[model samples]
Target: MQALYDVPAPAKLNLFLHVIGKRPDGYHLLESIFALIDWADTLHFERRGDGLLQRHDSEGANLPPDDLCLRAARALQQASGCGFGADIHIDKRLPAGAGMGGGSSDAASTLLALNRLWGLDWSLQKLKELGLSLGADVPFFLGGTHAFVEGIGEILHPVTLPEQRFAVVKPAASIATKEIFSSSLLAMSKSVAIVAGFPAHNSSENKTVDVTRYLDGFGKNDLQKAAEAASDDVVQALELLETKFGNSRMTGSGSAVFARVVQENGKSDPAMATMLQEAIPAGWQGRICRSLEHHPLKGWARD
Candidate 1:
């Protein structure tokens, strides 16, 4: 009631992303599984009864005037008409613009944490609705576990996933998400709305049935080509990962690439985590992450 501590907004890896089609409104139709990762951003919240929302980095300095965390707080305050406010302090771990959904996750975590701290007690449905307004990826974070995301990420189907380990790397270069969405490759690849894999049942509602089989399907990130073209750092990182891990792919619309750390027995290789951190380029960031079965803040709202 007074403060919330150690609340986490975990990063996500889009196990695979496909730009299957585009909508009439220009939003691309998408299919991907967003798996929560152990890498996370942590936040602490304390009550500020004067109804003024402020966000600070953990070092006690205010964050940028328009950081998503602050925006989320303002949005939630407006949505709930709550007469209370909070002082938000974030311990940011996820890198910006790495396609790891850091900003969106922070916004979603703000919605979830404040829903309780403010006692608005909004249902997950309400929280997700607010989340969608903040960013497309926010709903997937609110979905509580690994999810089959569709309809530009607003639609989510929670799915079970086998425990897995990933070695994720963020290149020294930055690739804007807007550029990836508008890249020439996507323009050439866009087509009439057809879900080639299962066209007949690809409608959003129908696709929610089950994703177990699709998870095992040979999936690839649609935006990787564009990412590689946009940054030499991305290309170098991907090449290194592929050489070391035998396979690698970009996550989301990325400058970040990831590969499963697999052993000869097909289980995840534990030693690779530390080795990767040392092997990655001098300025590049790398970490080994385990996929989460559920969001750390899963119980914050009703299912």
Candidate 2:
């Protein structure tokens, strides 16, 4: 039996999400930078000779019968005419409905891993097209870099982002994307601007500069208002983070909130996330996350 062990699917944060307009079909036009973070979900795969796709959870009993991992495998199988199937086991770390793009990342990882495992050697562009059919966020995960995303997520341009530490909080609440997108309270944000030394364009060739202050006033999450209204847990989580970190924003129509950790008293500390955790409710989960320059699988495929 052939297998891949301990493969990772990293999570992402939306530095800022701005809704510029709406499509004729009612999908929203967006301008946002998706940043990869160190937080990730791990997956293990073993090839099955019987052409049967199966899944299991190492942690015992959390995954559903039908999930994106299964769908992704099936999609790739149908696309490349591969006759082999595999057993996919996921060790889920990122929470669901947290707006951290966990499921999409898992799905993308499945496609990439299987493409290699099955020896199809599909190009990144071909995989991305398959990913898009799976989900809008899937392409961004496939792209494997911080990106300037637009056009309801079909368009992507790699962007250089500053490295900074962020504290994330996910209250005991699940936010449904469909519910938030359909809300009447959702509104469009005008535009986004960077402060200090950051470059204005989203390109790989562009110079990289510190964006510590760029995120301070970057822009508002267009869905924040609607998310807060939909989930009182989200409202409380943001309020708690804001009280300690000065400003807090929800990531990707989620109940999860995040704030930058700044130096205090002329000294920088790595344990500040612990301090931030002390301020939040014990029932909520908190962690310090560092932004990644690119996704772990960035080199796996070509665009």
Q: Runs in model 1 with CA error above 4 Å? A: 59-63, 187-217, 264-270
lDDT of 2 by residue, 273-303 (tens): 6676687776788888888878888767654
Choose the strongest candidate by lDDT.
2
1-303: candidate 1 lDDT, tens digit per residue: 645655899999988887878889988888777889999989888877899887778663335778888889999999789988888889988887789999999898888888888888799988888888888998888878787777788877666777777889998888888899899876333321344433232445524334455554357888988888889898888898888878898988888889876665544445666678778878888988888878999988985
- Candidate 2 C-alpha error for residue 248, in Å: 0.7
lDDT of each: 0.80, 0.81
Total clashing pairs in model 2: 0
Q: Which regions of candidate 2 are displaced past 4 Å?
A: 191-213, 265-270
